[model samples]
Target: MKKIISIYILLSFSFAYPVTLNELIDLAEKNSPVLKEKALDIKIKEVKKKQIHKKKFGEIHLFGSFNRFEDPRILYPITPPIDPRNLVGAKNQFITGISYSVPIFTGFEIEKNTEISILAKRVKEIEYLLTKNQLIYNIKSIYLKILSLQKQKKALISYKQSLIELYKNIQESVKVGKKPEVDLLKVDYQIESVEAEIEKVKNSIYALKSALKTIIGKKDINLSVIEDVRLTELDNFNRTQLLKNINSLDTLKQATLSEEISEKKVKIAQGKYLPKIYFTASAQRNMGNSEYKDLWQVGFIVEYTFFDFGRRKHEYIQSKLELKKAKLQKKTLRLKIIQKIDEALSEIKTAISKIKASEKQLLFAKEVEKIEKAKYEEGVSDLYDYLLAKSQRFLAESSYYQAIYEKESAISYLQYILEEFKNE
Candidate 1:
């Protein structure tokens, strides 16, 4: 009954759903606080764009006013019975009106302002994409590290098992007086070392999982059964094609859009020096008796700021300076992206070479281990030689797996730079 219960528990663990890289990224998209904040920023920019567009339609307002005055006396001595208030205006009065105004021309101010709003919205969109890509990169980094630790743990566990079996063989040899008891003690020490390494790796795995949970905003998720990291082949990468795709990067796009926005700001500042034309119309009714009971009027007005003590001039200069700065920044960003691509390509190449070398070394070490094991079993070799060979094989295996994961991580970084996460 106990054996059956243990088997059931093992099966249950095996059946637990494993978290995939895509799933983690999806969760981050939905739950990450940083992404959420960026989303709100995009919304704010969108609203601002709508406001700028709506301003082109003009405005209408309804207004009313009332006034009361005290009794008045005659102004002239000959008109002693005449009241000055009656000659001048009503003592109590009320007025109401509806007024409308629309801009007939704005020295391209409205057009430039709208362009600024549109560009601002695009900038926010790029910012959101940048944040999203960064989050994906972070998650991929953590996931790859976890896989590396897991691989190391597996290697250590395998090494520990081998040491155990070797220890058993050494103990038998000691009983036959063929090997010294100290050899058994050495094997015991090696086993303990491997076990210690295993423990350390397990702790690292726990810490990494906690970090991943924090990123995805899930505090209690179990991330033990993550998918294995797949290797990216060098033959599949094309540097020329990748460089062409660099324009799709969020960072580059953002810099370009920012430069455009700065240019629009310069135009907006220049608009202040030109004339503004507007069409105005109004209808009003006097509640109290007056010379005109109701009136309506319409007119057009053109106004220009002939001078503002160099205020507008200074603003225009400042805007041009900002535009220059933005252009420089955009140029710098392009160079940085090119550098990043080159670096990632180099890393991928280096990791691939290391992986190949480690694989060859592992194969050679495995052969050496086999020979050492046979020699030790036949009393032709010391425990030290056999243990050394086994350790070399273990290290080679670990190094190979580490290289594989490193290559995967480098590819993930390259994808991030290329904005492949956006497609995902």
Candidate 2:
């Protein structure tokens, strides 16, 4: 049993060192599955753009055909002064050729499509940044919470020790008949309660560390302990400055790209209403049992859809509506961004106020606990009053820490909304 206890103690301390915040953030970036997926999306958009651009160069084909006719005929068309000898005929015929066909005109559809693909790629890039910003924000928030909980655990441990000392003193008093037996029981109960609270804090810390491990993609990394996080103060911002810079936000940029893509779709629909022109060139060798001929031709083909069952018109209308919808979405996102920034700023102010209030509360609670401790020692106060004062002090300390971390969290959220991680 002693050996088992020794091994347990060794194992517990092995992973007790704190991992730095920057190191964790870097690990998350390097190993995040979601970020990798977004990167692949950008590459796909790039390939799509290339594919559309390649269409402008047209395509070439090598074609062949064989046939056995019912009757003898000329191997291929021949133009002459009706020379019967030269017009040889055969039943078996074969033709092989190379043809090149290119679109001479399609109302600029290829160009518009290429533009849309470029915009889509840009949108993907913006999405990647947005994902990264949110991810970092989440990591920071969790890290701060863990630090806060760790501090609370320390306070709880200290509180428990004080209670234990009081329980011992009360036991001595009860033996001497200087205090009632119930006072000893009361102190013992307070100690038990503090122990329970300490266990609760330990369980919370374990759960948070497990979640942090998943986020960084290093489930095996030792996060059994974490150091306190220090928050860097952010610069002040007013409505005017934030609004002026809102145009550069990634969400808005993605919306703009969507609007542009929709506009291109409308143009593509309009292109369908116009005539299409194609240029074709081919060279072929025609063979028969007794005749061999070589022919080459170059021509232009014009195709116009003079009628459709209002399909083109309906598509054009749909595209227009989609474009309108995208515009409205962009407008909505802009308003949301403004509102979020305002709310974040207000939260920061509220947190600062709480921090100040909690600081004073903690100071007063400490004084009260000190006075109660002295009075209890002098037999002028009851155990209940002393324990209550200590509990109040512990709670005040917890609240102060909570307020500070909340302010930091609010600042992190504001930075995420502004997409400030790009600069980092």
Candidate 3:
């Protein structure tokens, strides 16, 4: 038995460390698959930007070919059998060359393309931050819920103990012929009901703990021993100030960037109608039996689609339409975000009011329970009144606890909307 007790002590020590809310959020940020994917997307955009930058560097290619002809054709017709060999081409010939071309001008298309890539990369970064903030909010919400349930469990335990004591007292009174057997039975029934409720709460706690573990990506770790979380109060929140700061939100910034990118695309589409200038250079060698020649050339090339049946014009118009659409979408999103913030603020106010009312109700219920207990002991009240008082007190306490956590959850949601979690 001593050895078994020692082993149990060791196990307890191994699992005793309490995980905090911040630590859980850190774990979630480190392990979140969505954030990792967003990071990869940023890298992809960076690579695409590099590719666009490289477009101005032009391309170099080497070429080589060998050919054999059954009969070489003569470039000029000669009198019959008169120096036909002088006009005939070589039967076997080889040609090898290296060529390079660089774009000197692309009508601003490359510049616009690079800008678009830059905006795309910025968008991905904003998306990553958005995902992280959302994760933090989810973790905080779950943490608050678990804390509330734990508090409720404590209240239930205390109530259950009180019920047990009342049952024992009633049983003793019945034995002494002071209280009837039915009173003892009623108290016994209440005790059983409280026990059942305790069991139900324990099950709920287990399920919530499991959910917490999954969120933190630590399925093997026990979250049942996690430390209690403290709620943060946004005491100095001003709607005007927060609304002004809305532009700092990553979501809004992403939307704005997208609009700018669309405008740049319109410029790119317009550039398609302009001419392109390029510089090209090449060196070549040709060889055949008893003959060899070398040549080099460099030149400028200008290309223009001058007449593409109005294709470029149509594309430019399409891009312009897309830009307008992006602007409208951004404006709509801004309005929605403002509305959401207002809603969250209203919820916070409501929760604060609830907390106050529930606290007062809990105080009154406790006093009533005390008075009912005293009356029952003095034979001035029956089992039904005492049980009803106990139920009301428990309900009041539960409501108070729920209101506190609800306020916390509302604040968390408000912070989430304002991107305050990103600072953490």
Best by lDDT: 2
Candidate 1: give its CA RMSD in angstroms.
4.5
| Candidate 2 error regions (>4 Å) | 1-17, 88-92, 233-236, 288-292
User: What ordering of candidates by lDDT runs from best to worst?
Assistant: 2, 3, 1
TM-score of 2: 0.91
CA RMSD of all predictions? 4.5, 2.6, 3.8
TM-score versus the correct structure, for each prediction? 0.84, 0.91, 0.88
lDDT of 2 at 332: 93
lDDT of 2: 0.88
Runs of candidate 3 with Cα error greater than 4 angstroms are 1-15, 73-93, 233-236, 287-292, 306-310
Taking the tens digit of each residue's C-alpha lDDT, what string does model 1 give over 208-290? 89999888887766685998755555545898998898787778878888888898888889888889999999988765444
Model 1's lDDT to the true fold?
0.85
* Clash list (residue pairs), candidate 3: none
User: What is the full ranking by TM-score, best candidate first?
Assistant: 2, 3, 1
Higher-TM-score candidate of 1 and 3: 3
Which pairs clash in the backbone of model 1? Answer: none
In model 1, which runs have C-alpha deviations exceeding 4 angstroms? 1-9, 64-96, 175-177, 234-236, 248-250, 283-297, 378-382
The pairs that clash in candidate 2 are none
